[model samples]
Target chain A: QKEVEQDPGPLSVPEGAIVSLNCTYSNSAFQYFMWYRQYSRKGPELLMYTYSSGNKEDGRFTAQVDKSSKYISLFIRDSQPSDSATYLCGKNTGNQFYFGTGTSLTVIP
Target chain B: NAGVTQTPKFRILKIGQSMTLQCTQDMNHNYMYWYRQDPGMGLKLIYYSVGAGITDKGEVPNGYNVSRSTTEDFPLRLELAAPSQTSVYFCASILAGGGIQYFGAGTRLSVL
Candidate 1:
């Protein structure tokens, strides 16, 4: 199995809708989980960062990690058109870093 | 200060040509990394450096080379470009071990 797997979704949601992006990992040693947002031609920007399993909230974004299920998720509340972008999930296990194929999101007006 | 900067926002290189993608950080970060992103694919690490004079290969380092002579600069070198190497390259820096990595705008490279 791939170390990390994420649905390559062009998930479309209406503005003001709640958006949830998720990723699963096969590696159990992953200790740090991160969410990154990338615009059309720009590099990935660090959006949400969490040290371990649990939840972290920053403004309208929230990141959740479940080490038990080896899963991670990013939640966007009251999404806007500006939130349209690719969301990438990253896991760091000290030895190596793995990334999931990002999910493309579009917030429709 | 420019958190992290990459030169030549875009470039097109013919096969067998060579070029260097420059990455520099003003935050004096010790951990620097080079990653490439393909369409529909997430970023893949090419190379990483923990500090000056120290470097290591990441997942996808076969076609790339890197050197960290200073704390702020970690440049990725493409000796002989191949079409497979075409992708958007990004440079990122972290505080020490790892955390929120600051990224540059990215260099869109096309190897024809």
Candidate 2:
């Protein structure tokens, strides 16, 4: 099984809607969870990260991690067209990092 | 600070060709990594270095080599590029105790 698993979503939602992107991991050793946003033809950029199991809020985005279930989530509020991009969930096991296939989100305006 | 910079934004090479993808960071990060991203495959780590002169293989290390002679530079060498190697390559770095992993703009490579 892949270390990290995420839905390859081409999820489309209307503007001002709430969006939730999720990922699950098989490795319990992963202590750090991260969310990255990538635009077309560009590299992924760090959006937010949380250590262990907890919730972190950054403006309109919130990152939640449940270490017990090895699940991670990113919530976007008031989604806008500019929020349309691919979101990737990543897990870090100290020296190495693993990423999911990413979920493609498009906020229709 | 130029966070992370990668060279040869785009390249097309015939099978069996060899090339080096350069990555440099001005942040002086202690850890550097090389990853390849194919459509729907996400990012597959190729190699990583904890610090200068120390390199280790990641999940996908075949056909690739890396060196870290300085804290600011980590370059990936692709020898005998295969058609399967065609993908977008990304270089990333982070500080010693762990924090954010800054990524470069990525190199789009096509091996035909």
Cα shift from native, residue A47, model 1 (Å): 1.2
Model 2, position A90, has a per-residue lDDT of 90
Give each prediction's DockQ, rounded to 2 decimals: 0.73, 0.83
Q: Stretches of candidate 2 above 4 Å error?
A: none
What are the per-residue Cα lDDT tens digits for candidate 2 across A1-109?
Answer: 9989998998999999999999999967636789999999998999998786788999999999888888899999999999999999998887999899999999999
Q: Between which residue pairs do clashes occur in model 1?
A: none
**Candidate 2 positional error at A59, Å:** 1.1
Error of 2 at B18 (Å): 0.7
Expressed as tens digits, the lDDT of each residue in B1-112 for candidate 2 is: 6799999999999999999999999998999999999999999999999999999999999999999999999999999999999999999999974578999999999999
Residue A107, model 2: lDDT of: 97
Best by DockQ: 2
Each candidate: what lDDT? 0.90, 0.93
Return the TM-score for each candidate structure.
0.96, 0.97
Which candidate should be chosen as best, given lDDT against the real structure? Answer: 2
